[model samples]
Target: MATGADRTAFGPMVIVAADQHEARPLIDDPWARRLLPASGRLAAALTKYRPIRRALIAPTEKKIPGLWASMLCRKRYVDDALRAALDEGGIEAVVILGAGFDTRACRLPALAKIPVYEVDLPANIDRKRTALTKALGRVPANLTQVPVDFNTENLADALARHGYLPGRTFFVWEAVTQYLTEDGVRRTFDFLATAAAGSRLVFTFVRKDFLDGTRLYGAEAAYTEFVRKRPLWRFGLAPDRVEAFLAEYGWHEREQAGPEEFTARYLRPAGRDLPVSEIERSVLAEFTG
Candidate 1:
């Protein structure tokens, strides 16, 4: 319910919070509840009850359809990918690009022993620090907060100044690409291209048609709010082009997943059949060089 860049940070935390209330949640993020604003915390608390969940949460999920599932599914997907990469053994560090209120550094045990750098806007970084402090008493020692404005700053330089080294790293860019322009996305990719071979990248992107209003994917309300009204989203990529796009940047696409893939892989297993928004998709790519 925030505005501007900060809105992205808040919205996902709320979704995480709501997801936590599920009986068999695909993701576990109790810290999400603690890190929310008062209003968000109230919503999280109210939805804990069965009646409120059916009356309030169910209606919203119905209206938005796959919106909630999409967010949760992508989160689970990234988490699984990160864990598998860690298991394969070669990643030197983890960098969370455009990290908002993401608690992965604190929540995931796999990251507990490795160096983790969280890069984001200064304002979001500050808020994240405060929220983490309040929610967990202290920020985890393994995690370093690196503040950078992607529009005007050099990501590589920022990471270097923060002690990030050139090595095989796992980068998680979640729910952030749509807010950046094409040049911005390329700039980040240019930096990623410099990473050592075998480095992994997991990110989420919206469909190009959705951004240009050529397609709505049955979520007109989301388009009206995020596209036309506020005009916060700035870029999108077609699913078919994802492979070539990653190849152009020296990244080899490993997997590209959307609603159907998510429902089959994550939702149905938990005895849930929630629809996921078709407007978005996630990809796992590895540095080829």
Candidate 2:
């Protein structure tokens, strides 16, 4: 989240997303794979010399897996599934907020014909653009990068500047809300609330209990250690209160799934068991008014 020292954690998150750790990856992002640092590419490439990915990365990843990377895999599973369903159900545009190194616009074939707007801070956009151009020569035509600092610019204003339509849409706000202030979170929800009817929003949040000292998931110590020097999680809504929270913004909650739910609904069905069970949770909401 900072400019330099510890930096945006997107790089490591992308490394795990691009890794073929699972037999069938929840998300496939070549841009992530291609943009990796030399050492990361070497390690990631070494894993998949076709089949060695599972064997080599397994042992080392167990020692220190990427924080929230597995959770992202689960979140992406539900989010992408919801996206595909909504795409067929008639959403016209896809907007990805805080989309750092996310490759859904390029990777999901269903989105081939849909316009994708990716919003992020200018510096992060520069890094993403540089790596993308270096790896693939040019960014994709269907994808538009909108650079804005969330603290200063409104999400609605940024998208409107780039010709975003207030029509049927699917908004993906992955792993971003926890980084914002409570007021910022409300501002975003307010925007989503007014999106054309039938538009849906998919976003992730940390459990409020995690912040208030009720860690049920057994991974707390390691998670605590991980965030010691990093940007701390800023805001959260209790899982049980998400419905009431959404109601305040004129949206109706459709589904809220945690790692356990994701495991049962996605990973188990795929017969894929991640090294560490993820802890983050996601809520899917639909505009009601």
Candidate 2 per-residue lDDT over residues 1-289, each given as its tens digit: 3533224535454445445555766555555667655665677666665456555545435533433345545556555656665656888888888887776776677787888898887877887788778877888888889987665568898889998988888888877776777887888887888788888888888666665556635555534643444445667778889999989988888988775666676566777665444346787788888
Regions of candidate 1 where Cα sits further than 4 Å from its true position? 1-3, 55-64
At residue 39, candidate 2 shows an lDDT of 61
TM-score of 2: 0.84
Error at 106, model 1, angstroms: 1.2
The pairs that clash in candidate 2 are 47-53
Model 1 RMSD in Å is 2.0
Provide the lDDT at 101 for model 2. Answer: 72
What TM-score against the true fold does each predicted structure earn? 0.95, 0.84
After TM-score superposition, what is the CA distance of residue 22 in candidate 2 from its true location, in Å?
3.8
Kindly list the per-residue Cα lDDT of model 1 for residues 163-245, writing each as its tens digit: 99999999999988898878888999999989899999999998999989898877788788888998888889999999989
lDDT of each: 0.87, 0.69
